[model samples]
Target: MKHALILVALLGLSVTAVAQTVREPDGYRMDQYRGPVPDSLTGGRVLDPEAAHDLWQAGEAAFIDVLPRAPKPKNLPEGTIWRDKPRHSIPGAIWLPNVGYGAIAEVTADYFRRGLEQATDGNMDHPVVIFCLAECWMSWNAAKRALEYGYSEVYWMPDGTDGWTFFDYPTEVITPEPEP
Candidate 1:
């Protein structure tokens, strides 16, 4: 009976592993046009805001937000006050907007590579935490790229800004400088 139980356990483990295998649309990380997000990313462990916050507070991790900036409204009335929206992210998190979308334009690709290098100071072993809004793929792609770039430690915050705000964690606004 013990041997039979062990065999059954092994079968269950195999089934679970097969079930988690990456699939078509989810597996494909390079879609420029907006589409459905994958349930999982290729690399990095999924992290929550609380844990990320702990890491940030401990100064053991670098945080990055990959959300794209919203375009300014066009065709506004002549007297419209064009106040820029408040750009907030996890405290101490750098906002690198154009790095994650798959199949991006060449210019964007260059920007991403440069942004990443700048973020880590070219140190691939930096413990980096990446995030975006919930249900967004940009973070996933960016995390995968960081791993591909040979970062020893990469964490993906799947809950994103929503999760951070949900915990009533304070956020800070960070304006990204124009690329040189």
Candidate 2:
């Protein structure tokens, strides 16, 4: 009986680990875009990074950062500084790290909601693009939440912040409060 139970448990664990779901660290899944993304902000639609960048350059849209703060640098060595400020913000992207941990705190659901509120400014007609470092998930979760929140134009840069920098685009760096 013990062996049978152990075998069953192992099977379940394997299944869970092998799940095809693009489960984000913050619980965001890519499969969320299978349906309609309402015209919440723009009445037309949200734009991706490229288009959003064009709009930003043209003064039509805004880009946002959604990296959560960490208590200890998840990807950095000991004694690394938290990149919390809102500068080098792609000329227009706002910094809103989601569920900051390790060095970041206070990334609650409400935190996300508030950020969205600020992004749209009580209007669902605004276009916003959320991103962070590449091969990451916080930004993915953020973008999906925006879509679920009914924002019309939310772009999840599959490539992440690296994509932006990789393209040799513009960027800004700033100091953040790290809302503990």
TM-score per candidate: 0.74, 0.58
Give the per-residue lDDT of model 1 (tens digit) for 1-180: 677557768777664454445443544366652434455555677787899878878988878888877666999999998876777888877888867777677777667667767777888788889888876778888788778767878898877888899988889998764554
lDDT of 1 at 101: 75
TM-score of 2: 0.58
* Candidate 2 runs further than 4 Å off: 1-49, 72-88, 99-107, 177-180
Tens digits of lDDT, candidate 2, 89-158: 4755667754422222335656666766776786766777666665555555566667766777666554
Off by over 4 Å in 1: 1-39, 73-80
Please list all clashing residue pairs in model 1, or write none if there are none. Answer: none
Candidate closest to the true structure, highest TM-score: 1
Report the Cα lDDT for residue 122, model 1: 83
> In terms of lDDT, which candidate is strongest?
1
Alpha carbon deviation, residue 55, candidate 2 (Å): 2.3
